[model samples]
Target: MTALRIALLGAESTGKSTLAQALHETLPVLTGLRVARVDEYLREWCDREGRTPRADEQRAIVEEQERRADALAVGHDVLIADTTGLMPALYSEYLFADTSLAAPAHHAHRRYHLSLLMATDLPWVADGMRDGPHAQAPVDRLLRRWLREGGHAFVVVQGQGPQRLEQALNAITPLLKDRAAALPPTSPSTVGKPASGGLFSRLLDRQARLPGSTRWTCELCDDPACEHALKSALPPATPRVP
Candidate 1:
């Protein structure tokens, strides 16, 4: 079966790496299935070269990130991308005033079954690779704008640590269930099991659905004002398995 693709997107120090690593580790335990992760290629490039990529070097970074993700997707039940080519593409635009990477980056992003946008609610820390806290807001605005313009659906991941992982799992579990339902059971033993893929079936069966009215749509979700208003009106999300 084709792996479910999960793309994690966020500005610098917004916890993309932390959340991605959590999902990569937790998902396999929650679902008795294989999980693979493709880390941010740009991070490695920076560490190796001791500097960030130049405008001329952005395209290679985007291509390499996509290539690694594609390579990892085979034979895995899930693929979690720490970040996607959207980063380099957006950075290209934000830093170099170049818009050329947008189309290919969006094309790559569309393949993911789910996208999680890490909220900037966490405190930012200085890192050698980071552009600093000052860059987060503008970069975030650009990312939201990109998603809106592309008409892609993405859930915003909020909260801290385990709470954040739980939020992402809540968004992801439905897709897991849908995929399970679509496939035919190949064994009698597997026939009556919960669609959760394995162990945490009981917990997943009771996972809370996102509270929303019929009026909710991807377009509105990308809008910060609309999302905030809706989330503010809803009750707190149910806590996931501890």
Candidate 2:
């Protein structure tokens, strides 16, 4: 089976770490896949650097995590990564400020097959190192932007810890199962399609079924204008007589 990479991403104090740990404990029982957290790798890097890491350090941290995850993914069928405090908001902030900070090497949008975004509904509990005030609004905005940018994700809200864990498992299980099943079987004989039809035929068939072409029409509406007309234009109003 091909490796499954799942990334847990969201703002701080949103329980990303807790959820990652919960999933790590639960998923093995449900799916029999080994899970790894990116935090473990980050801590190791911090120790080696012998200093608190800045945002720039996250780039190297995430890259290392990606490399480690990719290598381990081959051994285990699935790997879940707990990502850093890098979200779309941080990316936009850098962009707006015109700062020189480059995006993290292993961006969640590109690296993970699935990303779980924890919501900010729960009260923020700051551990000693995380002393900043609750940043719910900013985090929420960032999460919305992240989803809009076209990543597969789910927003886990505040609830019973066990219930949240169950919900997360349910949401991810089908995706994992479907992807695992879709992987092409490893057999030389099945490498290519049958010789009865060539690749051109498949391409032509796809072209014939394309929407907005003469070969295919709107499935919902019978009139072409119904599909193409501007929503702002209402039917012509009768002229008022004077």
Candidate 3:
């Protein structure tokens, strides 16, 4: 199975690390597969160096983020990344007026199946490494712009702590089921092709054609939203009962 790589992203202190860990721990139990994680390398760099990265260091940060995420994805059903290179690249541009490191970050962003954008609505907490409390808003804007312009499928995670975790799980349900359906035993005879609306909709269309396909995708059907989204995404002729 192609591991589902989900990025928890946004400005600093938006709980990307917290949510990444939560999902990393919870998802495996839900999917019955090992879940792995790659956290923010730039923060590790900053902690080690005792200072924010210089322009020259930005490339290394972005590159390392990609390398770390790719490395952990092996032999796992899912890889939860705290942040992609896009964070450092976005920060480089927003904080240091640097753009050179962004291209590679954009490339890495494409590798993620979904990005859970941490909403900047929560109260900002100071972690000595963050630029300043005021820095989050503008950076949040840039992150949203990047996701939008990049055409990546993303959902903003709101609420606090556990509520936030639940939202992330909700957003990922379709993907988890899709990944399950994609595992071995799947063949040209059972798989479906792309259709309208989006990836989820297309997958549902294909899923409708195969017997027992619902068994693969319905593991998370207890959640009304997941159940409804799956059925709604399917073609009208194949309306599935939850």
Ranking by TM-score: 1, 3, 2
Candidate 2's C-alpha lDDT?
Answer: 0.49
The positional error of residue 1 in candidate 1, measured at the CA in angstroms, is: 2.6
lDDT of 1 by residue, 1-242 (tens): 77789899988998999998998888766665678999999999999999999999999999999999999998777899999998999999999999999999999888987778877778989977788898988988888888778766677767668767767777787787676555557633245566544645744754634455322233445544554454444322322110
Question: In candidate 2, where is summed lDDT lowest over 10 consecutive residues?
Answer: 233-242
Ranking by lDDT: 1, 3, 2
**Per-candidate TM vs. native?**
0.84, 0.60, 0.75
Q: In candidate 1, where is summed lDDT lowest over 10 consecutive residues? A: 233-242
Every candidate's lDDT: 0.77, 0.49, 0.70
Pairs that collide, model 2: none
Model 3 weakest 10-residue run by lDDT: 233-242
Error of 2 at 214 (Å): 39
Q: lDDT, candidate 1, residue 238? A: 25
